[model samples]
Target chain A: MKEMFYNRPKPLHIKGRVYKFGDNINTDIIYPGKYLSITTEREEMARHCFETVYPEFLKIAEPGDIIVAGRNFGCGSSREQAATCLKYFGISAVVAESFARIFYRNAINLGLTVVIAPGISKKLEHNDIIEVDLKMGIIISKKNREELKTIRLPSSVLEILSAGGLVPYLRKKLGVEQ
Target chain B: MPTIAEKILARAAKRDQVKTNEIVMAKVDVAMSHENADVVIRAFKEIGLKKVWDPERIVIIFDHRIPAESEKSAATHKRIREFVKTQNIKYFYDMREGICHQVLAEFGHCRPGEILVGTDSHTTTHGAFGTFAAGIGGTEMAGVWSTGEIWFKVPESMKITVHGKFKEFISAKDLILFIIGQLGSDGADYMAVEFHGSTISEMTIASRMVLSNLSMEMGAKVAFILPDEKTISFVRERTKKEFTAVLPDRDAQYARSLDVDAASLRSQIACPHAVDNVKKVREVSGLKINQALIGSCTNGRLEDLKVAASIIEGKNVHPDVRLLIIPASRRIYLDATKAGYIETLVKAGGLVLNPGCGPCLGAHQGLLAAGERCIATTNRNFQGRMGSSDAEVYLASPATVAFSAIKGEITEPC
Candidate 1:
């Protein structure tokens, strides 16, 4: 078992296609308040994910895709549903300039990696295959065969990602029964 | 050497001082959600998370947009039913239950000296019970759902002392609004505000809940009243649970201490675009309103409803103004109905909405159109926060909102 929650010194390689977005992507836009009562099934939620913000998101999203967005992504309501819907759809990670405090914490706690990459959203395009080297803070696009950018993660958040999430990480560190 | 919030957080995390911006993993004693469970479940599957760290620690309430206002909302609730069953999450409350904050308090979910986080901003309501509670985003909630632990930054502290006795019709709501008005919306930004002094000690738990619930409107990360006899009695009556008292050390320091003289305060209003844009009701008198809403976790208590009923008895709402009254919870609703408060309000031309968020979130019922103006008891009046971006929301006390409804404009309770 992992003894503590700490990010690996070496990068975890991520291979995925990118899904681009604009600023102020709120929880209501991610998973509209209207569909909040629907089932938690992955298929059910993935269908409605971004249904309002980008009506064609469901049709275009492929497994192992990445969502790149502008600042203040997930700005309203601490609805964990926004993160859940994205994870349900098999998205690999979310890279944005900034995120609402609660949404940022929720994403990391659930074991879904979210990186803060300032200005990367402006350079990215939909369906752009990229490799994210989290440890190294580097993004390399396979489509263009070029280095897109590098973004750093705070040491604390890196620890969370390394530990797989708060529960397992804390369990190991506290020596508690899991 | 830890700050007060740090000490409590450390006890929960079993650590010493959790430094600023440091991610210290700690178990979540309580995780509350509202009307957003479907997306949370979907996140669970995406990560292939199988079980909650602790099901009993989780609370899923369908309060926002309740009554399945639309076909889409209905479908969301349907999804929640299935998720709750499959997970056996025992704390789930259906639409008929009530708002999460009120229900949580009534059901003994909030306890003193514990750390709590909700997916709703009004989660600060738990602080009235003396817990350190704040709101977080859905993704972070998903993280808590999986691991039951969250990160934190030990915040600085601010002590707000309310001295003097309140005049007639002045309430805890007025006191809080007055404080925000003086300090500005971001006055206590990212700080823990501890409410102290004799007047704070005299307030009922319901009234204290109103005070802490709106602390978020002023951008406070945490707001709590000191645990006292009233708090003890409330916990004892509600949960039969015993707790050791937690108080700040006499020598403990605060970033600043704000002294509010309640005796000199009148009912106040937080104007549009910002909660800190406060003015005395008399200062804003004659500002006509199209609606008056009294509800939200902030002021939806039986006491609040009773106050409104008292002012509206035998007096109809302004014919030009639409008045909406909603209790914070179904229990409060039923109690108000049983006591004839609901009838009194209805007879006085107030529309009684079933217990839920209602107009507070601007989803259904009582939303204002462009150029409309309303006096509300709910927290937050940011631009377009209530309905159309062009509409204006003036935040005030339940009494003030009721009085305004009758007068058709902002007015002092004479």
Candidate 2:
């Protein structure tokens, strides 16, 4: 019942099997609103990730597995846990055709990886291993050896991610020494 | 050369000018958190700060799942209460208040051209007041609380121009639903949307709120309606804060310009599973409903309730249906009660609940059973939103919800 990621360093290399989902996958499905107050702990939130839909997701998904989905990946309500839960549930990165405004920022701010690839959901199958290189701007599918399309993140976003999230980025910018 | 958004962000960033997609650190005017305040508190502490950078600027509200439906939430609420007390955060509202957006408006916390950030997606509701508002994560909000600032990427603006008067019973809700249907959910992703034209100018506070509150459904970063005399009056009526009206430059560049003719729109319904899956009322009428909800930040204002009362005046709710009416805030509750809207609803067999977000997020209150269907005035009808995954929710206007409550089916408001 201890916190999970408080002391751990952020992961830099993201390569994992694809966990495929369809379009318009919302925050409710990502993290049910019912448990919003159950616990603020990220690990507790991970337990309820996709609790109703795909209830067995936590058991099926391995640490560092990638998630690929269709458009509007995290729509509905601005629950930050919607992105945090997936990251804590062991999803190394989420690659979607697009992300809802709030969810995209939350994922990037939390240092959880997210990529916009126009049609990665259709091109990639569930459990297909893939490597993500934001600098190289491509997700190479290991199974098919095909190069997937991905927009290289802008420098502003990269600056935040490099510092490992908005919290640490601010800590540095504000000159708050550890 | 700057649009309304560019102007607002530049002001917040303390710069003379800012352009589209430029990242800038903006000072926080208001930092708000509701049920997620506990999450923010946790993140704030993790940021190694025992004190919020600015106490008076922080607002905490206990709206979602209020009265502690679970032991965990009860403890969480206690922790938040302690944090609010110790942090000396003055603008704290307990379960007795209402939904965060409604409470903020009622207390006159959001002002035009001021930058505001909150923990709820519907924080965009403040955009109705012309505030440059957006929703962010708990950790990011904690950062704002600690540093009293947050970064924003100045979004290009999307202008939606509306004209013509609405037909009877075809309110702002229908017009917004129609607009959402025309442009899919991600239509305005990462953009600032500004409502314009004669139709928007003539709308009251509540109607404009419906347009701004639901703008998030189309993936907007923030939303706005230029502050006018009506906005000034509305804000002055609630608080003494002097307001600023932000006008878009004469040649404000809009990434896209879409027009909506309000006169030709119908009673629109966003069907089950997606908010943009909209259709005309006649297209999906007669679908039986197990419940009818008429409240939420989207349509829980006194004006919204008056329309519901008029529709069901002197009439009994259908025996097969359970109608739940909730006001958006305690002020609206008292106003509606004095106006006899609550009495009329109760006399008509509709159950009047406390002023809070009841069953809208499916966290607590009136949740539907498996295979049940509900027609509601609240926004968003995603699957499993109101309890059972098999249960379906249809989103419509308050008039439509009241009519459906009386008919036990999805009937057109007209």
Candidate 3:
């Protein structure tokens, strides 16, 4: 079989409104266990996304909004609902000081862009327009033009993200079309 | 030089060796999910794949919210059953099987030197079998179900050595809680913790799982023990398959090493709000509690039930306290019942629940009310973990939970 999908990394350029949260923002608070049994539909999960912290979030959230949080973002539980809810709500990307390991992997596999910029939490303000440049590993406060450097991801990960997650990447590489 | 984690990952990746911080696409020997497998099934569907990469390598168990607590859950379970059948997957366990992690180990799905992933944080429990087992998310699990290969960044190893003898009432839960208190929640963040020394080698298979399970609370990606004689005997008795033990090199490199004098450690407990907030049982002896629970993937095995039964054998639970006992698996429930542990607990005013993770995640059963306090053997004490966010949860060993039920307070086991 001829290789259809090659390991070609594509740089991402994301511009969105910002939503700020604090450190140790756990999954239970993001999507409670009570809702785990109820439903996992994107709309249903997005309705309750961050319902514990910001009950009015989904009502006010616009597509391409960015979520900025302090260290240990997405801590607690290994539920992919956390990433799925955000992706379904049309979140452009998530920039955090750090993320729990499982959540980081989950976000990548689900095609949700996550950027780690040290001290990015201190520079972000609620409702600020943030521009994420994956090629340069820079996240800028568009209004203030404040630039924050992000850790460059492995090329393989960037390829997967550009292909819209691992599943699609696998499909493309295997020469399978939906 | 590679640590035990690196060696195992290297082997799985078909590489001679792997270094710390290096990423490798390793083959998965076993991957699992519970009721949450519904999400995994969905993600796999979204993959546009006609079938799972290997049906036999995938295991799905229904343990959380068993017997379908609500119509929505029943529908989810129904979908999962259909997915299992459609995929021709053979490793499906219904609600009667018990907790997912316990079932995986009990049925010999976890083996030495293999890499495993599950959709539950306590999947770390299988590390007791010398496997590099860690928790992932449903989407990643779906990716594994599609490819049978997952990428991993070989983490730095934190070697924890526990030596000397433990006190009669001191269990693995106490030891792990003490270690977590010292290291704090982020102490082992994103690292692989290797447990060794005489204390670990001497513990039973069930006891060793306690250490690995709670290691997640400290933010460890995985916790493993080098396979030994106890491991061999446990696997041999439960499975007829021959196995090779995975051990660390004499000069295995570790990022850090911590020593614990097990004999000096006493009954430890984690107070409300934080798993790393530790206190001695004597310090909170008089603090009143509204409920006491003895179960979870952490400490719901036969050994734990026996200890709880021995403590509350002839005594009654406090009038103000409701004691709940849930066996981790059907096998354990049957063994405990056959040994009269279940009857003894029920006789002592305890309410026995079906074999499953009922109250641990607070999904259903034994939920706490506002301003209430609970002493439980389950891991994690986050707010609202059981029911109401206003309620407080204290984490302890099975013996402590049983004794506290009798005292109606957080009490030390006699």
User: Which candidate ranks first by lDDT, i.e. highest?
Assistant: 2
Q: What does candidate 1's lDDT look like per residue over A1-178, in tens digits?
A: 3232122222367888899987666666687654554544445766678775467888878879999998767655565667768877778889887765566766776567888777888778888888888888888878777775556767777776767655445445545533
User: How accurate locally is residue B231 in candidate 3, as Cα lDDT from 0 to 100?
Assistant: 85
B1-414 per-residue lDDT for model 3 (tens digits)? 667798899999999988888889999989998888888877676666888899988999999889888999999999999999999998999999899989998898888888999999888888899989999998788789988999998899999999999998999999999999999877888899999899999999999999999998888998998788878777777776666668888898999999999999999999987888899989988899999999989989999999999998888999999999999999999999999999999999999999899888878999898999999999978777788878999999998998899989888987
lDDT by residue (tens digit), candidate 2, B52-93: 899989999999887788888889889999998998999999
| Two-way DockQ contest, 1 vs 2, winner | 2
TM-score computed on alpha carbons, candidate 1 = 0.78
Where's the lowest-lDDT run of ten residues in candidate 1 chain A? Answer: A2-11
In terms of TM-score, the best-performing candidate is: 2
In order, what DockQ does each candidate have? 0.23, 0.63, 0.45
What candidate 3 gets wrong by more than 4 Å, as runs, is A1-11, A53-62
lDDT of 1 by residue, B1-414 (tens): 444566677677887556644545666788988776665565454434667778888899988887877887887788779888888898888988788999999888888888788878778788888888989865466667877777776777888998999998899989998888877655676678889899999888999998898887666778888889888778777885555556776776688899989899888888875677888888888999999999988898999999999989999999999999889998999999999999999999999888998877667878789999999998867555566767889988888898899999998776
Once superposed on the true structure, which residue ranges of model 2 sit more than 4 Å away at CA? A1-9, A175-177
Binned by DockQ into CAPRI classes (incorrect, acceptable, medium, high), candidate 2 is medium
Which CAPRI quality tier does the interface of model 1 achieve?
incorrect
lDDT of each model, Cα atoms only?
Answer: 0.78, 0.88, 0.87
Total backbone clashes of model 2? 0
Supply every candidate's count of residue pairs whose N, Cα or C atoms clash at under 3 angstroms.
24, 0, 0
* lDDT measured at residue B224 in model 3 versus the true structure, 0 to 100: 95
Error of 2 at B2 (Å): 1.8
